[model samples]
Target: DCEFLGIVGRNGSGKSTLLKLLSKIYTPTKGDIEIDGSLVPFIELGVGFNPELTGRENVYLNGAMLGFSNQEMDAMYDDIVKFAELPEFMDQKLKNYSSGMQVRLAFSIAIRARGDILILDEVLAVGDAAFQKKCNDYFASLHGKQTVILVTHSMENVMAYCDRAILIEKGKIIEEGEPAKITEAYLKLFNLNS
Candidate 1:
C-alpha cells in the first residue's frame, strides 16, 4: 500500500544502508527484497553528474540513468530548471556550480521521476531554510497519495510527515510502530524525553 514511512537512527545505524539496499545500490549480503512497482531513489545528489558537462547536459544524462528518453527529458527540462531556480546557470559546467546549486538541480530532477515508490535519504536537509520548506511542501502534497520511504534524523519530520516509522540500530530494525511512538522510542535511546 502507498504510505509515508520514516526510518530514523543515529549516525552509522544503517538507515542509509537500508535505503541503498532498497534502491539496489547495495545488494544485501543475506536477504531478499521484493518491490511491487517502479522506484526512484534520491540517495546521493549529483550522482551521475559530470564535472565537465553543462547542467543542461547533466539533466539529460541523469534522466537517462533514470530510464527516461531524450524526448521525455526535453519535456521535463523546463520544469526541472524552474524548480531548481537555476535557469541562467543550466549552460554552466557542473564543476562551476556551488554544492547547493548542484543539490537543488539533482533534487529537482529526482522528484520529477515518476515512480510507485520513492526512497529519499537526507534530501530534506539540503538547501537553505526556504528550499527546505519547499521540500517540506512537496512531501506534504505526497502524503497518503504516494509511497515514500524517507531516512532522516529529524523527529519533527517523522512526526509531521510519516504515518508509520521504524527505528534502526546497528543495522537492524529495533522498533516499528506509529510515527509518534517510534520517535519516542528513538529519543529514549539517546536519553532524550520526547
Candidate 2:
C-alpha cells in the first residue's frame, strides 16, 4: 500500500524493513517506487554527521546530503537551530556533544527538512525524559498536518497518535486497520506463540 500510515510490531517482525522499503533506502526486491517528489528519510539520528565538524557545519552537510543547495539550507538554518533549541551551541563540534544533544540536533535537521514524506524509524526514541517528551510533542503536533509514516513498538503512542496502522511480519503485512484493533491482534497473536 502507498498510504502514509503506521508500521508496527515486536522485534524482528519486519517493521523496520517496511520503513526502509518505503524510504527506498533498500528498494523492494521486485517493485517500482514512483513518487512525485523527494522523500527525505530520517532513518538514523546523527548517522551522517561528521564528529569533527561543528553542529552548524553539519547542518549544511546534512542539507547537502539531502540534496539541498547551500543557499536553501542557509535560508532555513535559523529555523533548524531554533527547532533544535541549540542556538548557542551551534559552533561546537559534534563529537563534543552528548548523545542526547546529537540526537536533538539530527532530529531537528531531519524533521525541519520536511520533504514530501517522512519515514521515522524509532528515531524519536532518543535523549533523556525531557528530550523524549519534546520529540513526542513534536510528533503529536504533526498529526493530521503532514504526511508521515511512523514505526515503533510504543503501543500506547500508536493508539494515541496513529489513525491507521499496518502490522508487518516476516517482510509482509499481516494486518492493516484501526490502531486499537490491529494492535490487539498483534499482541494476542504474539502471546499465543510465545
Per-candidate TM equals 0.94, 0.88
lDDT of each: 0.91, 0.81
Per-residue lDDT of candidate 1, residues 72-187 (tens digit): 99999999999899999999999999999999999999898889998989899999898899989998999878999999999999999998999999998999999989988998
TM-score of 2: 0.88
Could you tell me how far off, in angstroms, the CA of residue 12 lies in candidate 1 after the best superposition? Answer: 1.5
Q: Count clashing residue pairs per candidate.
A: 0, 0
Q: How displaced is residue 54 in candidate 2, in Å?
A: 1.0
